[model samples]
Target: MGARLLFVAALTLGVSGLAAAGAAATGAERCAVDDLERRVCLEAPARRLVALSPGATELAFAAGAGERVVAVVAHSDYPARARKLPSVGDYNRIDLEALVGLRPDLVIGWVTGNPEEQLETLESLGTQVFYIEPRTVEGVAGTLKRIGRLAGSEATAEQEAEAFLDGMEKLEARYAERDPVRTFYQVWDAPLMTLNGEHLIGRAIEACGGANVFGDQPRLVPRLDDEAVLEANPEVIITGSDEESMDNDWLGHWRQYPNMAAVAEDNLYTVPADPLVRPTPRFLQGAQSLCERIDQARPGSGAE
Candidate 1:
């Protein structure tokens, strides 16, 4: 922690650095930035905004800056008010012309996940973007603090971050007593893809006292087959529905796998599918929900 503070201190040597860098998430933040950081940096108390991910949208709402968002990605359905905001289309296939029409002061999205080509185009068009993806649960707090400062809602951000931190500590304590469960989390079954460990979701599973069946695999999302899954023989299976909604075909396909532990136990579930899909504040809710399902899959594994 001391080392981190020193790093931030050097990064924020002057007003110019403050403008260019996302400020340290501790105290009163100066949203001011240098001209270069001004072009790329985002200081909050942001009036006009666009959020291109469900997590980013919710983080804004959680930080009490929901009123500032003027545009959102098409799939960002949360807090009801987010739905009312103009849609800038999907993240991968963003409609640049439509986004520009909204005339937002700041645009928020994931730094790594979104298309760099599109982001480059947005930058070329003079749209300053903040790309943040929280890895651990604390990362969510750090992100909230950063967004809060950029949006000029330090008090709200701190409060929201504190509440999340407390919830996470409780979760950590709950799992401290037990050995980790061998669990398989299936994001998709067609190609048999699961999250890579570097991802926030996989880390969430590790923190929940359950081991990712594919923890050794090293991609953000790796594809596998029934043979690979069978090799793991996970004690529990945590899953969410597919892109086809809960339609008959999807359910029927899943039904064929009933012999599997997750299927045999009926451990499949329906999460928000929006915010839960992303790495944001709701990820705790997602992890908690997944934990609940896994506990059901194996009796006496977790809280009722």
Candidate 2:
């Protein structure tokens, strides 16, 4: 009787294990909508992936899919490990042959940064592509969650997204009622470019209680002359730099116009380009630095 009871217990455990294995084999499919409103579905969590832009690469790693990235475009240097991955080419132009050879399960594309024809061609080749372009702060968090969902790392992605939103909320709460500072953020020097309120950077300025001088421009990134900047006479001028020290002299040209409020008040500043320019979770660090600079420029803030 004792031997018979032990046999029955072992058989029951084996049957339970088989049932669990069967359930695992039929797990639910993963799907998410891209920024362009196109739904991408995967039969299984992407085991091999290719990121077409530096920002996309960063987003993938942030979604906890870093190890699954088989290939990335140029300048996907964040997370340190990404730099060691294979490159298919730059964001604008892809090495089709190389990319196709990798046999990635999913390809992460950039909406504006990638060529439309190339992406279509990639799709025609039976490759699944998901495009992303986050225009707002909330959009950034949403993209993180979506990417995480498709990558089978939803928990990590959700945590990162929540943390980013929390940081932004804290910033808004801290500076929402502060005195507004007129600001002009220079995107480029030659053919002088500035972002309108619709751009993510412009939104960051608004969050810091800084009024964007070019926020009313019709174009997202509008070109203007030095005369327009002089006319605005912003209180602070900020730009981004790729260097670690943020010591670029892009704002030096404005110094010659001492009559300009930003020049006169010496409120010109620079933030790290990667964090500020890229729509990623790390943007919180850039936003914090920007808010601090804007705060220092406020009256009675005691800046030398």
Candidate 3:
């Protein structure tokens, strides 16, 4: 089955499993698999936590452990309360002393974003670290439940996860049968980057019934020149911006190529950067917006 269908199938099975496991599970032991496929276990539910990335922080909060978080890395803003917490440093350069001083029983690390040496040092200091990198929408839900398990907030986490999965299922059902629209998603302006099918954003594009022009690329995020994008000539070109209004002119750069299908059909669009980029429950909202935009680009949907 496709990854999207697999997600729905897994969710149906996982919910029942979670309930049965929760009934049988003991408070003395907590275990979950990290993105690295490593089994991380805690003797007891964590009482104090530290998040190493903005996305990790959001997941922790979504798991109903916001009050347990002792520290967070930079840009951990969201849920309003996270901004008030102490900062250990940014994800790339962590301040070991500050983090250790917080006495966090659990440290949430970013698999690809965090510094490996720093994480090792934390482990050497006897701190339990859980690394996460959710590449698919289902991965995000799994991470949420795992964090909830570790934080002793399984009920809340499971509810939020179920809600997210349900929303995604609805989106898939709504768009899955629609005619596909060729798409190219711009990740960054400088160096010009796009995500491949393995990336979460690319997967979201597929869920919205849109085909990523660079989906077959080897790299998760590939850098290319303007000529390559011009050559792809996608039907719908999309980008994200930090600005809430998404008023930036990043997509305007495509205007020079009037012959491009996306430009010719005026199918260039932008969505909020945080919801789409972050691996959190808020991604559901982002996906909804994405599906709507792609629907507009469909030939019979009236954009033509």
Q: Who wins the TM-score comparison?
A: 2
Q: Where does the lowest 10-residue lDDT sum fall in candidate 3?
A: 1-10
lDDT of 2: 0.87
In model 1, which runs have C-alpha deviations exceeding 4 angstroms? 1-44, 242-272, 299-303
* lDDT of every predicted structure (CA atoms): 0.69, 0.87, 0.87
**Candidate 1 backbone overlaps, count:** 9
Tens-place lDDT digits, model 2, residues 1-304: 2454345434534553454456458885689999889999876787789999999999999999999999999999998999999999999999877776676768999999999998897776567899999989899999999999999999999999999999999998999998999999999988889999999999999999999999999999999999999999899999899756877777998988999988898999887888988999999888988888888778776442
Q: Which candidate model has the greater TM-score, 2 or 3?
A: 2
- Per-residue lDDT of model 1, residues 102-206, tens digit only: 656567867665787886766655566777667777778877887777788889989989988888788877766667677877787677788867777787677
TM-score of each: 0.78, 0.90, 0.89
Q: Write the per-residue lDDT of candidate 3 for residues 1-304, one digit (tens) a residue.
A: 2454345434534543454366456647789988888898876788889999999999999999999998998898987899999999899999877676666768999999999998987776567889999988889999999999998999999999999999998888888898999999998888899999999999999999999999999999999988999899999988888755778677989999999999999999988889889999999988887778888889988532
Ordering by lDDT = 2, 3, 1
TM-score of 1: 0.78
* Prediction 3 TM-score vs. true: 0.89
